[model samples]
Target: MGRMKPQTLLLQSKKKKGPTRIISVTTIVFGSLILLLFVLSLFTTYRYWSQRSRNLSGNNDLEDFDEDGEKFDRPVYAILDTSKGSIVVELFKEASPEIMDKFFHLCKTGYFKGMLFHRVVKNFMAQAGNSQRVEAAEDWMLDMKPQNELMSTKHEAFMLGTSKDIHANKGFDLFITTAPIPDLNDKLVVFGQVIKGEDVVQEIEEVDTDKLYRPKSPIGIVNISLRRQR
Candidate 1:
């Protein structure tokens, strides 16, 4: 007993740490690393979204018809054939020439013939495009690294959504404004209006939607072609 007492005192004097202390220290270090990673991730996301928002105004119209013939300037036209019905959309070259050019090419090639409107928000709008195209656009956006600048256009009725608006994202999909949401004015680009078959849009909206607002049934565009409504 005397010898054991001496040994215990010696061990105490050495200040040996227990398993719990060692585990606690390791956990603290790991927690600090995790916190640092989270902060970095948040900062990166903010910077990405911020860059996308620069030069971003909601008033731009992606396409529309010039009611008055006085303005001869017009953008290229592309007609779309949907399961609901046919729709005609007029383009706007004055607002965005580059985007219009790309759109025209995509249409002429029939790239969006069978694409689906993968996403639809009831009160907001419908979004469609080529899934592969969207991914490619996002990659290009990250590669180019756009600067901050406000678009000098107005958002009308069915203006198209560009990769820039959603952050260097593009696809064959598009969306139509359900009703006049005052808050979206001059913020989202309005490219065109529903020339015909707006009822289809209504029917799509009426269907039961999910949390993301996507409809239970698929809304597919059977075919798309260009036409002059002279």
Candidate 2:
């Protein structure tokens, strides 16, 4: 072939460049689509796992509520038949299990039968459960010693009282609050609350008291009956 003309050479170059450019553009578009698809797939997977985790957490919460409901349904209650009147208390097992267990055991064994409300403070609390005064008692007082283990609790109105001394002696002394006693929270373990007949507690607090804050006459605990209900 003779020396090619400039136009011919230019036309050949154009023809070669057209297919090269098309191939480059097609490769870039295909690569971009692949990257976009990968990103979308990653996002979808992340969302699925996140939703699944939340669902599992929700289920766990429901299960916890169910367990709590079962315990709450069959709570242990104490009925105090006293001279003033009857007062019903709902013992919290979860808050102070050890103390409540001891209390229930005492009630079951007639340990609180004929016990006196030894210490009574107006607008504060009424303390009792001292088996020391029982006529037929023999080493029963020693058995009533409180286990002063500190448990988490709040000092609210109508709550029962426990103290370090009471725990030390393992004494079975329990007190019912007539008012809120937040000041005693750190020093006292409140294991139960008056659920019914709070007015009876107030009436007892207003009864006759001498210098020692003890009832002048006799504010006796006739008996303590334990009732389990659902």
Candidate 3:
């Protein structure tokens, strides 16, 4: 204890010498470097999240994913084939071109095959995502980041909604509303609507859940098939 104090006092003192002064200078330099690094890291973190917020949740969506803007004006459809039955969804590509494009591609590649309808709330929504599959997904699947942005759309019954992280980044996680969700209108992007098989959505929501809202028997996606109506 006696020795430790003297060393701390020495560090605080302004006295100079050969080795002692050199050690003191070195300590000061190291401390200054640490502070600089901390400040830089804070700035960098802020910038990275700021840019992501703008890109992912801001007013804009990634440009018409198609090179020639082809998919933007079309009527894109996604059929979620489940154990209960098929739910046909009419995706609003014109409103969410980028999100629809990625959804279409993911459906085409069977990315959501056998994924559970993990969360179901009666008269609310049926939520699903191949989250565990994404963790072990190949490079190509990982590269197809599910980009999203909020639109002027509202959450009505049968509307498809995209999921967002705390950072407001979008992912393949998705939900379909079986009833109007007034509170979620500003939080999640409404990407599509169930045009057929509303009964299937209701049946899926009838699934029993534990405290975690997960279905007891594990209802799941057989696969999602995509098509466009011209």
Candidate 4:
């Protein structure tokens, strides 16, 4: 009977352990599921914020614009004669007075003469400036007054803008959009739009460029001469 009693206790102990093991396994599985859900929630929130950040920074190609504003009639124009060809840009004084003031000063002073169209971002913009201080060395753009914050002008195809990008140090130069870049409306101040020689503008856009968008062959601004339009 003593031996039998010991054997009976052993069987009871084993039976108790069965339910404990089962409960432990259930709790571990529940915890694993909770952890997975938490990770997924974090991933979803990160994706949402990442997209919003790209839109705000104007760094992505996602396109949307509510208004580009009305077209304006102006009497002045800029002639950008490049190695590729001559492109005419209309200066709308009513649309952007402050921006035009800066543009005119730069143009009249021969700031763009012989400068390289240094960078081109496919489907975005083509930027031009003196690679070094040799061609457009004055750097007078640094002393210019602040750009208009409330300007309503929109950045459309062939439009000339003053933004060199937040990362760029040269606001002394200009850029041309190959397409309507509404994302830049807030970041860039538009001074003019191509009124003629759009084909020339497109030709520049199609030029073969290095990975950094520098033209394989130098495409330069031969001169930028401003004149009055009838």
Query: Which candidate ranks first by lDDT, i.e. highest?
Result: 3
Flag the better candidate by TM-score, 1 or 2: 2
Q: Alpha carbon lDDT of residue 85, candidate 3? A: 95
- Model 1, 1-230: lDDT tens digits are 34568878888967875555345888989999999999999999999877665423111232242333323264445566787776666654454544555555566556777777766656556667644443432233244322233323343344444434533454434666555434343344454556565677766656676755555787778865654451
Q: After superposition, how far is residue 98 of candidate 4 from its true place, in Å?
A: 3.6
**Model 2 C-alpha lDDT per residue in residues 64-119, reported as the tens digit of each score:** 22222233435666788888888888767565555665665566567888888876
TM-score ranking from best candidate downward: 3, 2, 4, 1
In model 3, which runs have C-alpha deviations exceeding 4 angstroms? Answer: 1-71, 130-153, 166-170
Give the better candidate number (2 or 4) by TM-score: 2
Of 3 and 4, the candidate ahead on TM-score is 3
**C-alpha lDDT (0 to 100) for residue 144 of candidate 4:** 27
User: For this target, which candidate reaches the highest TM-score against the unseen true structure?
Assistant: 3
Model 1, residue 29: C-alpha shift (Å): 99
Report lDDT per candidate. 0.55, 0.67, 0.67, 0.66
In model 3, what is the error at residue 208, expressed in angstroms? 1.1
* CA shift of 107, model 3, Å: 1.1
lDDT of 2 at 206: 90
TM-score of each model, in listed order: 0.51, 0.56, 0.57, 0.54
Residue pairs of candidate 4 with colliding backbone atoms: none
